[model samples]
Every structure is written in C-alpha cells, then in structure tokens.
Target: MIEAHALIKRYGDRRAVDELSFIVKPGQVTGFLGPNGAGKSTTMRMIVGLDRPTAGTVTVAGRPYREHTAPLCQVGALLEATAVHRGRTARNHLLALAQTHGISSRRVDEVLGLVGLADVARRRAGGFSLGMGQRLGIAAALLGDPAVVILDEPVNGLDPDGVRWLRDLLKGLATEGRTVLVSSHLMSEMAVTAEHLVIIGRGRLLADTTVSDLIDRVGVGSVLVRSPNGADLRDLLVRHGAEVTGVEPGLFQAAGLDAATIGDLALAGGLAVHELTPRRASLEDAYLELTREAVEYR
Candidate 1:
C-alpha cells in the first residue's frame, strides 16, 4: 500500500504538484493519469524519495522510502534506465543490487528468469535494445521481490508486444495482492489495465475514483445521431424534455434519452431514422470535461 498526504512540490512560483493525496490499495492497479506536464513524474519522484516534497509526505508501506533499512527490497522502482558498465552483464547489475541489500545471487537469477532475461544474463546492458532495457529494468525491480510496485510511464517507447507484456505483468502483480501504481499518458491502455484512477491537472486533484465512476461523472454521456429527419427528431426529443443539439445539417446529438425511446418516438411519429448508435464515450472526453476549469495554462 502507498499513501500521500497533501503532497506539494514547488519550484519558485510554479507549483508542480499541490495538495495531492491518494491511496493505492493492494490487489488493484491504480493509474495516475493527466496531461503533459501534469506533475505525474514529479509526484512519483517525491514518492520514492528521488525528489523531496516541498510540503507534505508520502509513505510506502507506512514509511518513507529513504528511512527503510533495505529500501530496494521494500519498494521496487524502475524510474531510471539500466545503463551498467558496457563490459558488465545484465546478471551482474542485478547481482550488484542484490549484494547491496545482502540478498543472495539465487534471487537475482530468479528475477532474471522471471523477466525473460535469462538468455541475455551475460549480455552487456549497453548493447541491449530499448525493449531489452525495459525488461532489464523490470528484472531489477523484481530483484527484491517487493510487495509494492510503482512504475512511471512503463509503456513509453515500448513496442506493441512489450506494451501488452507490461500491462499483463502489472495486472498479474495486482491480482496476486501486490499494490501497483502505474502512471501513463496512454488513457486507452489505462482504461483496460487500471481498476482505479487518480486524475490530476495543474497540480491539483481532479478525480480519485474507479474508472466507471469517473465515466459516470461526465453527466450522463450522450449519443451522436444523424437522421434525415434531424429537425423533426430534435423537436420530438425536446418535447420529451431531452437535451438536443443540431450538430450539422442533418445530424443531432441527443442526451437524456435512450435509443429505445428515440426509436419508439420515430416509429410512432412516422419519422424515418437514418442512423443511430451508442457512441463511444472516451476517457479523454471525460477528463477534458472535468479538468476544463482546473488547467493552469489554457
């Protein structure tokens, strides 16, 4: 479990993260999502003690990361790339980390195998591809067999297969009762991977709820309908106390009315329907709607 209380970070007058607080529960994948420069990275840095918080505090397993006797073993972090000595192998990097925590070399090999880096255990990290580097980073994170995992933009720069692998791995960790905190710009991927989300903007909390709750908070999403009898349908929907918008020449967007009601109205009034569908309500739209007033820079 991870917790942040009134976490705040500032550089001069610019507030990178302000009064942000949230909890990451075990057995769930919690997503940290926001636009570019939304303080996701800064907050993560503060959490793991990579950067100190200006005002507030963050705890991993009820203690700050720096205070832990064996910090790596208590919290596994992949905040940086794996750039070991060009001559040293991947296994050596992990072994060195294991040595720092007084862990055995057997655990190093276990994590190497777990992250599918056993074959390249002898390969120099400098020669590894980006995907391989990411895997090695993951192997290092798992080296301590930590109970809580925090990843910032884990899928960034990764290929499709690697992205899916990371997603599945995070999901698997959460399923096994490990707390997972993943920060990403990929909302669509987050939609599939994260059970709960903490949305922020301009260094403030916009939302802290389940994915479905955030979607529902978009004030009952509507569908875009295009009908030859657009005006007629709009009038009918208006009469039924529904919000209707004439978006184009022959297209109208309707809310407060379901498809069945619209269909029954058109059928009873002899109005021909051209097209109707339950539109996909994107998380981006929901986020934009919620953070429209919270954004600091336009």
Candidate 2:
C-alpha cells in the first residue's frame, strides 16, 4: 500500500501541494483526478522521490521510495512516457533498467511482449509513435513487477483498443494484489477502471471516496415520466414541489422528486402512468459537480 501523511510541496511563494494526505490500498485501482495546474504531477513526482516535499511524508510499502535498496522493485511508475532516450531501442532501454535491478533478459522480453512491443523490440524509441512510446514506457514500468504502480496520464495517446488493453492490464495488476494509482482526465474510462478516487484541486485534497459514493453524493438525477395526461400530471407534480418539464405530448422530465413519489402522486391524481424511469447521474456528471469550483483553467 502507498500512504501520504500531510504532504506538502512549495516553490518559492506558491505552494504546489499543501497538507495533502491519503492512502492507496492494494487489490484495487485508485484514480488521481484534478484539473490543470491542480498539482497532480507535482504529487506524483513527490511520491516517486523525483521532487522533495517541503514537509510531511509519503511512503510506499512502509518506507520512502529512496530508502529502498531496489526502488524499481518496490514501485513501478510511468510519469512521463517520453522520458526515454531518443537513441536507444525499446528492448535495450528496458534491458538497461533490468540490468540495474539484476532483472534478466528473459524478464525484459516478457515485459516487452506483455506490452505488445515484441514486434518492435529493436526499433529506436525516437521513431515510435506517441501510442508506441506509451507502450514502451509501460513495458519499462512492468519490468520490475513492483508491488506498487503509479502512472500519470497513461492513456494520453492510446486509441480505443490500446485504452481497453491498458484498462485490462491495470486491472490484472490489481488482481495480483498490487497497489495501482493512475491519473487521467478521461472520466468515462476512469469511471469503469478505477474503484476508488483521490481528487485534489489547487494542491489540496478535495475528496477521497469510491466511485459509487462520489456519484451518489452529487447525483440528483432527473426522472423521466410518460403519462397519458401529461399536462394534468405536470400540474399535480408541481403542486408536490416537482420541477417538471414537458418533453412532448405524453412525455416529461421531473426533478426535485423521485420516481416512486411521482408514481404515487400520479396514481392519486388519476393519471395513467405509462412509464416512470429514473436517470441516474453518470460519473462525468458527478465529477463536474464536485470540481466545478476547483477548475483552474475555466
């Protein structure tokens, strides 16, 4: 598991991270979410020991990342997919990392194949496309088979198929009991991939909650109603404090009330109800609501 206790990072007068604290448990995927300039990259850098925190502590598997004898084996990260040397082949790059950790050529080959880069193992990283670069970076991260995995914007350049493949790969890692933390802007993908979320804004912790709970907290979904007497039903619902909007001759949307209550009201009002369905708020809807005030880029 990964833990952060009152983490803080500052640059001159501006604080990049401030008193942030959270835990990323194993056996599940935790999503790091924030708007631009929300200090997500800064936090990830601190977690991997790339940036020094001004105060507080962050540890992976019970210790700081730098304290580990073999840090790569303790935590695998892909903070920047394009950080690789432009001149080196994908295989050789991973081979160099593997060599440092006493990992074998066989394991390098295994990770290369695992990331679907086996065919282009000899190709130089400079020639690889954005998607291919991401794959190669992922291959390097898995080379050590670490217990904790952290990735920043992993799906930045991936296509639909690659995105799905990455989703499965991360899920598989969590299935193996690895602590997985990934940061991404794609809410639709994060909705299905991450079980828990750590949301921050302006360098401070905003929420730490599960996907379902987050949705439920801000999810006041509207109700769709179909009735033969739409006008009469709308009037009755308005009387009961429902903000009703007409969709057509026989269909309408109702808010400030639920389906069951609307159904009961319609029944009492002698309205023929044809359908009463509640549209649950989606992850995107909830995220926008929670982060509305936190968005830095507008």
Clashes of each: 0, 0
- Quote model 2's TM-score: 0.89
lDDT of each residue in 1-298, candidate 2, tens digit only: 9999999999999998999999999999999999999999999999999999999999999998999999889899999999999999999999999989899999999999999999999999999999999999999888898999999999989999999999999999999999999999999999999999999999999999999999998656789999889999998999989988888998998988988999888888788999999988888888888888989897
lDDT of 1 by residue, 1-298 (tens): 9999999999999999999999999999999988778898899889889899999999999999899998887888787665456577999999888999999999999988887789999999889887788888888877888898888777866888888888899999999999889888787899899999998898888889998888877644676777788888889889997888778977888888877788889889889888777564577767778877776666
lDDT computed for candidate 2: 0.93
The reply for model 2, stretches above 4 Å from the true place, is 227-256, 260-273
Positional deviation of residue 185's Cα in model 2 after best superposition, in angstroms: 1.3
TM-score of each: 0.84, 0.89
